[model samples]
Target: MTQAPGGGTAGRWAKRDASVVWHGFTQMSSYLDDAPVVVERAEGHELIDVDGNRYLDAISSLWVNTVGHRVPELDEALRRQLDLVAHSTMLGNTNRVVVEFAEALASVVPVDRPHVLFASDGAAAVEQALRIAFQLWANRGVEGRTSYLAFGGAYHGDTVGALSVGAGGFGTEVFDPLRFPVLRAPGFDDPSCLDVAAAMVAEHAHELAAVVVEPLVQGAAGMQMAGPEGFCELAEVCRRHEVLLICDEVATGFGRTGTLFASEQCGLRPDLLCLGKGITGGYLPLSAAVAAGHVFDAFLGPDPSPRTLHHGHSYGGNALAAAVALRHLQLLEERRVLANVGVRSAQLARLLSAGVAPLPGVGDIRVKGLMVGIDLDPPGPAMRWGRRVCAAAVRRGVLLRPLGDVVVLMPPLTVTAGEIERIVAVLGQAIAEVTAS
Candidate 1:
């Protein structure tokens, strides 16, 4: 192999990584051919590979990084909390920083009198929400309210409970046996999907305990979106049917969709809300399943009774993560990050429209705030256009990943005008190069 610019080599680093690492959703057989970037350090929104190449983090570090990498305030918050305490179990006991962080979160989340249950990952948050919704009925003496209603393109999480509600794909079909069936509604791509879902809720209200949705955008479904009016109608139906609503905002939370949460735009106050990803500003692993006061009260009973949720995580409320999350929430308001999202969203939309949408290989282009997916249209099934195009972009110093044929671009919320332009330009170049051949 040829020598790299930096003292270390990417090939050498990848070999070391592949020998010891088992990456999720990745095939280890050809991992070396995929040309993964071995990042040694990060500065702001760019990641410097072991070979000394700097690539703009257009995917927001797998859609978790909110403000940017190495944010000074977030770093300080983590360091400050580290000096105080690192880990304290949240089982039957609480941490000061955790309580404070939850209080601040409850104030802003679109849940009424929210009570939070901390977890370690987005999947865990969604799984807990599923368990809570299932048990909320049993605690209230409601019989046969055991099943859930989910949309066609929904992607909740990979856990058994979460996968049960999610529309299966992404090579998860083998888990079909583990996934308990749910009442299915059409995907958001259909104009009348919400109406159909509302009707299904009304019809199946007897056995249905809850309805889980990815409000505004079905992120893992290639960014399929629906109007806010549709969500408003669905919320009304859920209320009328007395079915609990669970909004999985793991992907759309923390100002990623031009608001603090996507539920705000959709006029929803869910009984259960799942939050993660950017909760700690991409600094630490922390997720939360927030239950509305009404739902939370259902689980209250004797100290050692069945009403209590039997679920708890060991590192659920790490003080260090809580401290960073508290500061990250504050930073969102202090820096006016939502205001920046609105500006950058409009700029990104306009540039993508002018530059990429008109390209021959482009199909549907979806945009919701900084989240975007550009579909690639290939005549035959042999071409992996999405993969090849993203590889081309990565080679051009812009980091992007694809959801199958949809090239996803989730730039950090603090992306600048120049960076947005660069992303669009590189995307266009990559698309042209892949489609022409």
Candidate 2:
């Protein structure tokens, strides 16, 4: 076995991974040199690799983790659920923990009389929301309302339905044949995004089933953000048109946006809400498609009626995941994690402004709560500045990932002040080193 710099075990694991693992969004041919971090464990907000290198989780393990890793209450919740039962079907029956978690989630999510339909991941949740929105019109005896309205630079998920509505990028162009096109609106990158979207809604309201959005920030679009007022205005336009509004808070939910859900900040009580990522505090895979009372009511009818929305996953509402998610939700309030998010967000803004923004090749820095994106100057095809800078930051013990030329930083809500400083300092140095090269 080839020995890595610090350990042979990591090298062996990497070799084994290269042989058997077909990772998504990765080019397997050059995976070793490009992406080499093999995480062994996590503590608080840091990830320990197999080579004993510790890297601060600046992207919250791809924007899922919230409170921190290995939180005691979350751990205990999983253990408690494991003792009772691990796997149960939510098809015909429901479990206690799932019901309790949904109840807890309903209390916080910005949907009137919310009823949750559990799914295993964000894509599945988004897919559920899309189908629910489509079927709601059919169930209400409404015709021609079969289309959807989505913004450019929007990313809901990777599933077919979600991808159909999503603004296509991320090498998803190859699947263009399979994706069903939606009524496209300009994204937040354009100042007139809301104006353009409202116009589209006004023009197509008769045939549009729903207007789907990422609320205030489109994380996958390099944290492209819209004003909360714009979001409220869009919601009003959707309401005025009598069209459903689906808020995909997969990335902005669970206090990531300084609010439990971004919809809360926008004062949007969406007809359907898609939530995931931090729901289980990164402990397990759990997502929910929450429907308003009216939306849920539309699907109800006599037993075995065709009005029922036919969709489900085998692992939907797993007891352990639900239990951990419930505890995570409780801890969010008890520990006042959102308050930390507000303070840390300010610290991050100041640190980035004072430290990284002046560096060469830095174009723009966008931040909403702890979710951040630092857009680098446009690089030539041969110059992967964002990737190189992130790799440098990783070597310096801060793990950062990039979306093309946009360097993203989505640190855990519980990241300490000192840790935030370290992340910023390392990022600045990394940017300098890469730019100088």
Candidate 3:
């Protein structure tokens, strides 16, 4: 075990971390016993621990870092904005960077007259969209349309409103009492999925506020993918039923799925789009809930009447975050990130299907642009092959975090072909080592 450079011991950080921080989704009882690695610094595609070991960041720091870590442009953008303003409430007033970000986003997103409502992170974006959906209905004289429709195996987020629609996951067990009722349809790719969704809309159209989905790929749900065929079909269903379609593109946005936005691939425009993660290239925490003109129009009324969407975070449109996001968008356009994602996505799919998927214990391999998922059959003991693979990959100097039983990889969009090859090579070796042992 590597120790910290400070005097007392190498694992001091772990002990200190364990003593104070209660990590999310972690079993803290055995935290220090296993000696957690404390990250000291990061560079492009690499993270260095306190012990001075370097590891390739195969998961892009939980699928956020697109332009890569410590980029000069993003750092400078943040610094420049910080020199002016850092945080502000997104009520009554707006900042210049925030306005620029909204304009840049509107130019790329599919909706005409797209208006952005800022938030701080992915889950917050989900919450904002949910509230907007319900508020739109209420403002339109449809006071009964408060229930939402979500797919089984969907994972929108962890917040109360987000969790309400996130079915087929154990995460909501503790919060079930507090969560609102949300109708669940059969997940995409199920034999009767579309039929099930149609039936739900038919049965609940009068009461449906919205249908939220992780468009194209359901990231937290084992990276389960549904092609554009069903997505376009679902869009039509939502339109016909007058149910607002909310595309949770927090994971698939910013060219992660070979397109600037996954909704574009389906030839469908969502009523509300939730974007985060790579929006600021992982430089700062930022998210946006974009709505069409019709949706936005629903909230326009006299000031004292209070028909507005009643939600705003303290740091909703932080100027630094907005500036960073603007710079990141510029970088994406300048580099033609979608083109790179397309090329690398195809190469990764071919390489993994031909090489890694055939290995022992490897059951299935799925790829979408820069995002990839490796499902291990039977999952074996430890019960979560994906989590084990992540730990194993770390030992082999590759940083990865898996979703349930899926050993997933979502590297930065800026990664080179050579880096892609090395990432896959190390991932394959890690899979073999973990499965073999």
- What TM-score goes with each of the models? 0.98, 0.98, 0.95
RMSD of 3: 2.2
**Cα lDDT, model 2, residue 64:** 96
lDDT of 3 by residue, 1-437 (tens): 22322323437777877778998877789766544557889878788887787777788888998978899888999899888988776799988889998998999998868999998889999999999998887788877898999988888788988988888465558778888888988775474665678678877889999988887787887777887777777778789989999999999999899888999998879999999999999878999899999999899999876687879888888899999999999999888887888888888888788778888888778788988888887544666677667777777677787776788899889878887887778778878877787
Question: Candidate 2's residue-wise lDDT over 1-437, tens digit each?
Answer: 11232345676788888899999998889888765788899888888888777888999999999988889899999999999999799998999999999998888888999999999999999999999999998998999999999999999999999999999999999998999979999989998898889888989999999999998899999999998987777888899999999999999999998999998888999999999999999889999999999999999999989899899999999999999999999999999999999999999999999999988899989999999999999456759898999888887888888999999999999888999999999998889999888
Candidate 1 has a TM-score of 0.98
Q: What C-alpha lDDT, on a 0 to 100 scale, does residue 110 get in candidate 1?
A: 94
lDDT of 1 by residue, 113-227 (tens): 9999999899899999989998999999999999999999999889898898999999999999999999999998899999999999999999999999998999999999888
Question: Which candidate comes out best when scored by lDDT?
Answer: 1
lDDT by candidate, in order shown: 0.92, 0.91, 0.83
Model 2: weakest 10-residue lDDT segment is 1-10
